[model samples]
Target: MLSICLIFFYILLIISLTLFYFSMFFMFNDLVLFIEWDLVSLNSSSLVMTILLDWMSLLFMSFVLFISCMVILYSDEYMYGDLYMNRFIMLVLMFVLSMMLLIISPNLISILLGWDGLGLVSYCLVIYYQNVKSYNAGMLTALSNRIGDVALLMAIAWMLNYGSWNYVFYLESMKGHFEMQFISWMIVLAAMTKSAQIPFSSWLPAAMAAPTPVSALVHSSTLVTAGVYLLIRFNNLFINTNLSKLLLLFSVLTMFMAGLGANFEYDLKKIIALSTLSQLGLMMSILSLGYPNLAFFHLLTHALFKALLFMCAGSIIHNMKNNQDIRGMGAITLSMPLTTSCMNVANLALCGMPFLAGFYSKDLILEMISLDFLNILIYFLYFLSTGLTVCYTFRLIYFSMSGLSNSMSLNSISDEYYIMLKGMMGLLFLAIMGGSMLSWLIMVTPMMICLPFYMKMMALLVSIIGGYMGYEIFKYKLSWELFLLKNYFLSNFIGSMWFMPYLSTVGMNYYILNMSYKIIKTIDQGWNEYFGGQSIFYYSKNISLLNQMIQNNDLKVHFYLFVIFIILILMLMLI
Candidate 1:
């Protein structure tokens, strides 16, 4: 059945990709194919299930199906021994299907269906391993997303003021209405949760408890980009608003924080997760700055390479007996040359190396932002975050690729790399060329970027320093020990994801769970016990005693009871 499903998805992928490119070259106006099933109509408004098609949604859907197809094929080996292998493949397919629904919906009510499907399906995937760690991570991911889900519902209710469930129709006309301000705020909040921006961030790293294929598909590419895609679709509504400016401010902070966290991270998978978070921040910040297309370009290019990066990481982890700590790995360059080469290419592309997939979008985003009307602070954060990306990528490359061999003697670099590399080879080509190809296809006219020599070289200069710092910190083992020892408190805080996991789980649970316990005790033990069970027991006991007296066998007792009953009846008759 799984193989049959895989064959089906492959056919769909080919069709979607072919259509996406064909539309890219030929379709001029927005090509929309909508199906409206009028389930209900109230107060002159209609609710619909709409499938909207433009070049963007088609392109995104194609990428999602491509990654999912590769992930399913890769799972043939990655999940080889699993008892419920069929279930895992189904869950991945369901996740992709949900993302497809999300990408196409133009109606807010219909979008919520897709949105909630994403949350529910993601929770199932996160707990696929069903261990203590996976359980906690799943709960964290679910609860954090519920916040956004609720926000979307509220936004839908607010949209009633416009008399239509379809927000696409009114985005341009309703941009200036004060009553609709809350809708904008709520949408941004929902995007934050989905994108794993800032406070919603720790979940992304924690979600590494799932299999690497899931981490590649859900975390690196499709799921995280859902929020950015939504924002891009609704970008026109955010113009000239204080909320967008606030989003701009905080998203940059998130970008900086993610970069700093990735530098301190040692887990191979979590570092990639952090990089995903950082790129999300970059996309969100760019979207808030009114350049949705640039962000979109980056989103697509990042997905290509990041997914490949995870496949390579999964290949490494699988061969290393599932040990994810980078410190425990080294000298695999001699053993797994192909996987190492792919990993290095991904790391370089992520660093925005010249002409790679990441370069085409990332470089343009930075150069364009420099021309925007902004203060010096933002100007610096943008370039510094870019540098931090290079720093961590270099750090990751050095330790995981070229550092000392510290693995246990039992660890063997397996030669069974055929299936895994097969899955990655498709994305590997795109990660190298997708950026330039998409840039030309998507952007009709190019911007003539004019900047001072120093400004032009800013990203390069910081990236170089960051790379040096990464090499030194890992090359000199003493530096790692010294930094942690001296900066114990601060290091721990950052290393622990700024203590967000503790706060979101235990810290939150302490009071809320305690309150829940009290409520249970009050209802189940106190009020219900006294008023329900105890009272029923006493009343039943008294009734049994009265019946016993009335049925006594003694003649005198029976005669006395009968006389009293007759006297009471006679008094009632007299009255």
Candidate 2:
């Protein structure tokens, strides 16, 4: 008997494969089709529903569908027997629908519908656990995304100058138009927040409070990549402008920060989440460098492995009775060979190992940057980030796969969940082969590379050193003189993601929260109590009591009031 999840999975898989072939055909033929429906018109403005069919959008749609189908299939086993399994499946489907909508729509209004849909569904998914932690993470995720929503809205408003909301039609003509650059700024701001770049990055790791399938699908692929996808479409706005330079600076910083933070992270899901952030930064940086095709290629490949990585992490977490700490998960390979193998492949691919999915895109991006006339800082950060990526990935592998079992003896960890393994296996093949496949199809004209021997070898040299350092660092971590004990502040700073979580949460909220507390105390509880509701209640009660006494014929009070009034009137007459 087939379950609901299986039903959706089979249906979506067929659709994904169909779309994939169609996208290839369209790419080969250089075809584009637009279907627009004008719903309303008011003087100079119109409401339209636009559907764009191009190779890029179709290819992305196919990948999203494939990943969604796999995740939904995996969730069937991962979330088995839960009371709200149906609701979980529904949310995931809605998220897929939202991502598809985002991919197909070239109009700003249509994009916002998809953008806000992703944000809203992600928040729902994040808080799905119904715990305090989930609630906080959900709030952070939602609020951070709301900033981008606002920027998109502002962009929509500014688009009134063009008398059209379809940014697709305007990209070529709007170049070098200083008066309209505000729209580009708004678009970039919106993209930054959506993609979790730098200041907006704290939410990506925090969002690991969501279910693992959600982490796999939303954080790793669809939701976070929406911003990068949008930027790819808007790449024209960046040509011959300093906007790309500014974006490159911030994005490279995001890459370095996330890579550095992941090395210190212990939680299995969060390390992956931070890694997703680093990859998003890499995508953004390359996009800023004016290689939307390279960024898009990497995006597709990263989606494959990152989703698989999360699936493996989810399996481990589920089997470990929800324990996510890597320190407690050594020698996992002995029990779950398939899961460990899949995870290792994903990690190695992330490190840009030869011929893997990450290699074709990541290496090309690095090589292109080497050839470009970039400043020293950009080059330094890019290479440093590349090394840090390897360092953290190796550290993760060591802690989780290569040590003595820290778990209790009774642990039943194994790769017996065939349904989960099936989902992972599907992506495993792609994680191995997707890079070469995508590069051949997407890069119609192969890039010719010219670089110094040392520069050409820089990525490999850095990886070798970073791997050795990772092993040494692992041994150091287990030493009697733990680095955390001797240099608590430095370790804490790095581990805590440069206090970004603090700044994003308490630091940003403390003053406002304090002011709100004071207002509550002084107004609602203090002055308002005395002069507003409390005073009104008290005076009304006293007046009612006096009326009751008068009605009860209490002559003493009435006679005294009457005598005082008469004396005052008599004195006034005499004056």
State every prediction's TM-score relative to the real structure: 0.87, 0.90
Best by lDDT: 2
lDDT of 1 by residue, 1-575 (tens): 55644574577568667867856744466466656777788997766566777778878887887878787777777788788988888888788888888988898887888889989988999999889999989999999999899999999999989877778888887778875677888888999999988777778888888889999998655678889998998888786678788888878988888898888888999999999988989999999989998998899899989999999999999999888999888888978898888888888889998888998999899988877898888888988888889989988888777856778886679556687788888788988998899888888687789999988887778888888888877787677879888999998887777787788888888989899899889988888988999889999999999888878788998789799999999999999
Give the C-alpha lDDT of model 2: 0.91
Which pairs clash in model 1?
Answer: none
Q: What shift in Å separates residue 37 of candidate 1 from its native position after superposition?
A: 4.3
The best candidate by TM-score is 2
Residue-level lDDT of model 2, residues 1-575, one tens digit each, is: 99999999999999999999999999999999899888999998877789999999999999999999999999999999899999999999999999999999989988999999999999999999999999999999999999999999999998988878889888988777764688888899999999999888889998998899999997656999999999999999885578888898899999999988888888999999988999999999989888898899999999998999999999999889999999898999999999999999999999999999999999999999999888999999999999999999999998899879999889898889999999999999999999999999999788789899999999999988888888788866657137667888987888887888899999889989999999999999998899999999999999998788778856887798899999999999999
Output the worst ten-in-a-row residue range by lDDT, candidate 2.
475-484
Misplaced by over 4 Å in model 2 are 38-47, 516-575
* Residue 555 C-alpha lDDT in model 2: 81
Please give the distance, in angstroms, between residue 480's alpha carbon in candidate 2 and its true position after superposition: 8.4
Model 1 off-target regions past 4 Å? 1-9, 25-47, 512-575
